[model samples]
Target: MGEKESEKLLFWEHMRTPIAPQHPTLPKLLVLLILFVSLTYLVYTLKLVSTSRACKDAPFSKTIIAVNATASAAAVLRRGSRETNPEDRTDLRHLVFGIAASAKLWDQRKSYIKLWYRARDMRGVVWLDEKVKSEENNSDTLPPVRISGDTARFKYTNRQGHRSAIRISRIVSETLRLGMKDVRWFVMGDDDTVFVTENLIRVLRKYDHNELYYIGSLSESHLQNIFFSYNMAYGGGGFAISYPLAKALQKMQDRCIQRYPALYGSDDRMQACMAELGVPLTKEIGFHQYDVYGNLFGLLASHPVTPLVSLHHLDVVEPIFPNVTQVEALQRLTIPMKLDSAGLMQQSICYDKSKSWTVSVSWGFAVEIFRGVFSPREMEMPSRTFLNWYRRADYTAYAFNTRPVSRNPCQKPFVFYFSKAKYNSTMQQIVSEYERHRVPHPDCRWKMANPAAFDKVEVYKKPDPHLWDRVSSEEKLLQSEEVKGERDHGDRCGYV
Candidate 1:
């Protein structure tokens, strides 16, 4: 038995193939390890490259690079903060006004400039076509006078337009060349334009002076806007140019003027330049071109919900108040403007439920009492009291919607002009008085009580300096409710 087992084992061992040493597998494992390492490195390197590209495409990439290069991170943050700081707001000191007046009209128009211009607090120049006579005793009260640079080189091809449009347009470029420091805005206006300085600052502050902006308004006349441009900022109404925009304009404005010889006015030429720079008009309804004739009552009484930044064509319109000189009327208006310019001309509608009467109070201006309820929507539309700029044009030619002066005796509003306003210290409110402006109306047998019964309309309001801040939400609510035809009876009723 032992011999047979030993022989079989020996035969099987001899027949079986000999196995290779385990050492060969070491090289294969080494190759796999090398591949794994290379793959890991490639994956890590690709992730780094992707991160770098992401950083490069980021908006604050420059800020990050600046932070990395020896500049303290706090310093970089501070620079960003400085640009956005609320305290660094646009102010009068940052503005340089360019008032366009001819030496011929300087005597008459300079008085208008004196009404708003504060030489002590403002930096500006009165650009006259020629040197004004030295009869002005107190030159200190006015902006420093400067004769405009000659524009004889510029060609004006418009047969109907004044060639002085070329001169006026260059006032901005000339003002820029004066090398005034820290100027952020250049506001241009005709001598007749009366600015509400505080409100102008409020508007200018909303924009970034470092960026480009062209701020003003269109003319009230549809014909004027269509004939000139819907994109133009009317010069008479006054337009503000951001410092950056003005600088860009200074570079190309003369060339721009040359290109537009056929343009009718200074504003159109300016608009052509703005178009080249790809800027559009940023309209502010408060700046009134007032391209109309007659009393400003209709427009002022229902001013759009914004600060009244300026009024142009003052000489053309009747004095704002009855029986007062234009200058005196403005002085009276400024009283309320000083108390609360934000609330000035802001319309508020209320119901006198006891009398079943509707009262629409245009704070700081006028009040109108109607015998029956009138929709705020109707009251918001300005009454056609003023004539269109083109005497031949009718109400249909207006840029805005206007309601005809009511011919219905029953529907006529008893108007009251603002008489005086005083602060009631104990109540912490402003008590404004509006005396009834007596006008004869045809008698009607309508059952509604007459608005003429009331002699004075008294409005008590708490001076809201921040009224505009709340206007957006309140306007939205008003619009929503008006649309639903379910506006609450007490909504926007009183001072509260």
Candidate 2:
């Protein structure tokens, strides 16, 4: 009874003994810590998911949008800076010329190259099919000659076209392969093409050389434009490719030319590559392909309101001047060109109300005198003294506006060709003389004024570097003053 009672009492005593409170503060703090950690993890996971979703859904957030906007603005600013920086301007040094020449024509055409080519200032190579005899002893005055890579692999199916077209089309790519440094433009031309280097630079400066530009002009013949692409830059007139574009062409040009077997000429093939690259021709009216026969007087006398960048097919057309070889004529033309390149071949018109005569002055080239008053609009249009490329084609075949050669002898322009110019240092004037081109006109019953009375015309001009800048204002002044007969007087056309 004692042992059983002791065991029961001991068990009762153990059960009745209260357990020590598990340090209530410690347990309560531990539970709170665990809940805090779990709650924090849940909240963090939800926040991470929301952020990921926002990044994926709204990719261009304000920060990202701002970055893109800044990048675009920076690009525009870079372009603007490059264009405006006078030190970064496109000049003779920035141009690399690739002339497409035949060994056969090289001798005859090197003179044309020598005219505009300032060897020390220019970076150029005349790419010929084969080495010419003259190339061995080539002068430092002329561009260095190089033999073109054989293009036997390329196929040419155009019956009317010469296979040399293939080689010519690859000129820019070959030029790029030479790895010219600091070259902004790769200008391509035929051996016969003559460039006014200053005007060429002026024309090039108008465009962004960093961008892809296939700059040139259409053929003078409308049929040529129709046959070829109206959009194609005629290589004979010469064309320029931006450095970036030439590099881009170097990537795909060989493959590109292979695709166009039936294309007629180098320009078309070059244009084909440009088309593949999604670059359209940047037609600058200054480049003259001169795809016509007969006298160039009508064309040159009334040059469009742009710089005369180039002239091609000089051999095909009559000598520009009345009585000289083409080379001599160009040499003579350089006189006024040196004095004022921008004003070269730029036409200015005024009236002599006393004589009821109209005077059109082709600065640096020629002067035309009409007995009757002619609108500036009519005077601006070239007279069709030059024939179209095709003998069968009519005056309407020209790409530009052309007035008919007047059947009435009296209505014909009494021409005065540019002779000599002297720069008077004291006066700061370029005094130029233009002699009468004596083409005897039949006597007309109607008498207005006699242009033949003058043996020579003297033009007094101030050497204006900013001639083109004032063109608009001068034109406006001409319009305003012509009606009042206060712009120009007989035998003396004052600057309006």
Candidate 3:
């Protein structure tokens, strides 16, 4: 028994003392394992923090930059020494353009006209223009602008004229350099196209400074011409450029100018360069670049159409301005015209004299009068029910006759009187009752009579007498069955 107790005490002591590892490398192995895990965790944490900060501080994802290329040929010729009007030197905010004199006169004229019109319309919008004229004849020499550490030159061969796409590109580059801000968004468009100023302003106002670049108004034809290998095809009349996108374009411009100088005629080529530089061209609608002649009318007629950015009226110049001005002036007029009784009688006689004519004749007169006096809010068909309910006589006598019948309170009648007896609700009911009671006379066929002619007649129909009784009987039966089922279930379960 003493030996057994000693063995128990020895076992307890063995349990209390820590066991020494048989392999000396075990402790070292454990220490190394722990150190490795700690180092890995520390490295991972640092990397995560660094990545998070880098993402947080990044600039706006995209910004809208608008570039206009519609400066006059004269403006282009005076590029080198173009006078900088102290007043014209507003901090070049958001517009860019290139001017060149030696290009084809036709192209220059078209571009110039478009540019001037757009500028006039986009008075409040931000834009930039690059002077492309020669400094030789001009007295003023503005500070030289540089791109890629080189003095940018707007060069054009005199013979190539409008056919020379190189000069146009040079003008575009000069404008872009001057207009681009540190912001991310950008736009490039020709002068001839009409831009909705309010719509653009509204979009820019809501645009987040940090987001992907968006190009508006993509055309399928332009897309086809662009090589997808470059991953760029924002085809349309105009496109927006992000700051990152702009930088990418600037980087690729030199290479593109050298490699695909022939592609300069197409704006899609410039877009392709951006694509090659890893800037994505987002396909978004809103930028329209087609010859939109009819679109102007639709835009003007729109409910809240505001300032138009650009309008290209190749023909009929005075119609837009003069008509718009006249309408505006009319809107400000508040003249109150009164018609004399003699004048009303004469108008009524004239209308009555033409009553026998065809519907087209009647409609023509109505439309002419409508156009002259009242502009209908919009085109829509007349409501059939309303027209039928208010007879033409009632419309002429009461609705259209705006004048008071009499000045004295006692002189006016509560009800109107007419030569043709007025048909009212009381007269119609009696006729319906008479018809219901009549049996068919074999010899005399019944003809529908005007119920309005008769008065003080009442018509009544009997209600179904058995409906309520039948409903009550069904309800009682359903209730009784439900109660019986509940009792049966309870009895089967031995809980009743």
Candidate 4:
């Protein structure tokens, strides 16, 4: 029991074990070191797991849904931006429509409106003059409007060509006063104007109602556009106002109308009012004002960079889709067709990677990429099929800087071929053509430039430097004539 005896006992135990007694301090240090290292490793592992989760949470932002996808198409085409999902959209309930029509056209508007509007959750009111009011019997969607001025005329006065457009202020003022408390946007368009609701919803989400925003695109008609204020949101093609801006307009609308007596049209008047409020026109590409007269074959065939929103003046123009009628185009628009963003935007021209079929808006210019993956055989007399690589179109030889690949019209793929010159076709017609053909895959690359760019754009023969190069236009048959030889051409030619 003495200290010497205890020491002697410890030595004997160590000797028996054949191991030195570990330092008491060393044991504590070793335990602490192990705990520290384990904690550091665990913290590092947790950090890596958090980063991976964040990437998974976001597939794509809803705001740039189609845009990013379309950009992806550009990348894939330019070997850049690739357009993905066909039917990505936000809430339609937040958007409301306002269709301005003549009394005579009220009945015509009702049919399509009734057909398409209900399914998409669209809420709208029809504005008609007193004459139409007298003519209309149903009176359900057509609200009774009371204009401040008497004797509304197509010609507001001899000096003004405003037609009934002079009534725009009152119409918008009334629409806001109608007490639509639910929706965030108030979209304005003519009765003849047709819209793609899914695209419309996506477009509306890009803006904020908290700001005073007026969104639309310019009229496609160069003359009409020049005659009118370039800053205006051409009413016929369709335009939208955020809830806050509409409320802002309502406050001074009466006075604003009184101030703009000399304004020639409703759009200009609206622009003037917006200017007073310091609101600028926010231009979007999807809206179309068919101010031009003629077939929109080339324009629709090329397809646009953005989603198709509205198309106006359906009566004057032929259907832009390859081979379809107006009535059929109207029907296809109401429901969801198995199409992607580019297809849904109503492009007349598209290339199916799956089918390799390239259809154009021209009368009968539909061609398929008939190259088989396994065979890679050339047919002296081929049926329908295109080269699979074209199923993934490489570069759209645009007429810009000839900079290999870019959606930038001025910068690259300098062989601008698609026409930006005009658009007369309704968005529906383009959709109809694609639904039947479904030409291009959503991810396939497309080159849209001035149609003039295609002047010498024939795919060059093999063993020729002109392959996909700019060549003389003299020997080449035009796209119109090519339609006639499409079947024969498919047998002979490998290029689009």
lDDT of each: 0.85, 0.85, 0.32, 0.53
**Candidate 3, residues 1-496: lDDT per residue as tens digits?**
6999999999999999998868688899999999999999999999999876845654444111111222333343343132245332222233332222222233333333332324432222212133344344212211222222232443323342332344334334444565545433454544333333333443433333344464454332222333222233332245555555555456567666555534535354565455566556554334433222221222222212111222332231222212234223112111100111111001100111121110101100011011011112221211111111112313222111122223332222111101111113563411111111122222312232221232222212122212112223446689557644643332211000
How close is every model to the real structure, measured as TM-score? 0.80, 0.80, 0.33, 0.52
Looking at model 2, residue 260 earns an lDDT score of: 92
Report per-prediction Cα RMSD to one decimal: 9.3, 11.3, 27.5, 17.9
Can you tell me which runs of candidate 2 are displaced by over 4 Å? Answer: 1-86, 134-137, 469-496
Local accuracy of candidate 2 as per-residue lDDT tens digits, 67-130: 7767866765775687589788677999999998988877788899888888889999999898
Better of 1 and 3 by TM-score: 1
Error of 2 at 378 (Å): 0.6
Candidate 4 lDDT tens digits, 400-454: 1111222333221112122111112443232212112332223223443222212
- Candidate 1 lDDT, 1-496, residue by residue in tens: 6999999999999879687767688899999999999999999999999878856756787656655654544544554475477667567999999999999988888778878888889999889889878756646678888888889999999999999999999888999999999999999999999998988987876667888999999999999999999999999999999988999999999999999999999999999999999999999988899999997788888888888899999889999989888888888888898888888888877676656677788898899877777777888889888999997538888999988888888878888989999999999999998999987878978886777777887788899875554324446798657734432463444321
After the best TM-score superposition of candidate 4, give how far the Cα of residue 23 lies from its true spot, in angstroms.
65
